[model samples]
Target: MTLRTKYLEPWIQARENLERRDWLSKDKEKEETQTLIDKVYNALGSISWSANIRGFSNTERTVTLATYCTDEWLSDIQENQMLDLLQRRLQHEPGGQQIKVESVYFYILLKRGYDARHFTCIWETRHALSSGLGPSCIGFLVNVNRNHWVAVIVNFNSRSILYGDSLNQEPPNDMLAILHWWMHHHTGHRFTTRSLEITYQKDAFSCGLLSFNALAHHFLPMEYPLIAVSNVRNGRLKILLDIIDQHLDQAGVRHLQGRTLLTSLFDRASSPSVKNISSPSLNPKPLLTLCDQKVLYLPKARLG
Candidate 1:
């Protein structure tokens, strides 16, 4: 379905109609509708699945799936903060409509995706990276003119960015250029960039899921790069749902397969064993082998 045709056609008619009408709600509706039109027009290149997930209610955890992964589900700069708070608070409190608050959904999606034409959306992304614990690969999510989510990784240590789009269009030149300028101006950090060969994202709304998956895998890599290249390059919805489940666990997210997903990924990548590696991006593939048909031998490869 062409969102441009579906969304713009009616919107154009509405705008024309509104020019002559004098209704009280006309201005407000027009503002909201125009925002939607702009957002759709601005983000038309890939798949995005941020706001589409429905979740269980606190009062009705077993049945209804009405909650969103992010509260606002639009876009905002404060989204990461919101997500952090929700995870911390819910881990101890448990049971609340608390999950309904907005975070990464609006901050990253709506503002950066729709508003980049007017201002520097890349600033928030950069700040978010600098605020992290170390010089690391940061996921730079953005939208284009076709309404899809694209994933880029700003590798501070390598001084480069890896641009990956679900739709496989040309690299997001504007976004990368802005990011390059941001890094250079703020920290004198120069960067080279390359396009990454990626798997499928042909569906309409898979962009958000794909974007989230890219970041998640980096922070929670599998036993092998090949494994990720196979199992997760597609079937993103399941992984996305698992991530939401990881967040909803009020007992606090457990360390899985040795340590927490993010911890293990980062630690295993930086350990002394693999410390001599050129790029953390290409270090140890999770060593995987099969025994009898009984169990799977999946070992986390620490830095060599």
Candidate 2:
């Protein structure tokens, strides 16, 4: 097919359905976005952990299950769900990484809250913020208003920040200031600001999903901009929520005490020399490197 037929024609088709592209009339989009927000809040509240992923299945060992999430559980949770379809459409899904956003440690971390303090603990792996290359993407959720959320993405690899708010307002300076400090302090890099790929939100409640949108798609393997907006509009945000829920669901699957040494999993994948989670008396190797940023040597016993 010709380039116009392949590229230009599709944009025309998508543009015709601006609502699908989230280019809707202001009032109408607000109505639809609010409805989506309500559904998401309910979905998040009602999600259940599958027995298989929840450590109830002898067929699946708990410890290894901590490492691998079954698609069976994924399929169930995402059936007719927003996240299910996003996974189906995402051009680049994470693979080869032993740890995931849905690991037990991750949920525990989330349960407590996600803030700058846990940066090292929450995102210190190749699969995390890192592009599996030298570059990395950090998705920051900031509450600029007392109740409204704003999503900010810092791409260290590109030294750029992509900010999004459905309200179409600029992100607060105080939030950006803190994020700037955190990025420099945590990863030792600086990033500049850029307009988000799509800045419009359907309404107020969408900040949560909208921010997640920034983070979730940062790793998309598609071409520059890696835009997945059009496909997810029109109450299609369950995709983002399901990603978090799936991880939490997987986290719920770990056996009591079997949930130990979650950090060791990332350490193991990051550097072969690192120690295993202390279980069955794990004997860790000397710490050689913590990704491309730093290096150190710690006793195998101290890895946990």
CA lDDT of each candidate?
Answer: 0.38, 0.39
Candidate 1 global lDDT: 0.38
Per-residue lDDT over 44-124 for candidate 1, one digit per residue giving the tens place of the 0 to 100 score: 111111122223222222101111211112122222322343344333543322222223443344245444543354456
As a whole number from 0 to 100, the lDDT of residue 210 in candidate 1 is: 54
* Estimated TM-score for each candidate: 0.40, 0.38
* TM-score between model 2 and native: 0.38
RMSD of each: 23.9, 22.5
Error of 1 at 208 (Å): 2.5
- Residue 68 deviation, candidate 1, in Å? 9.9
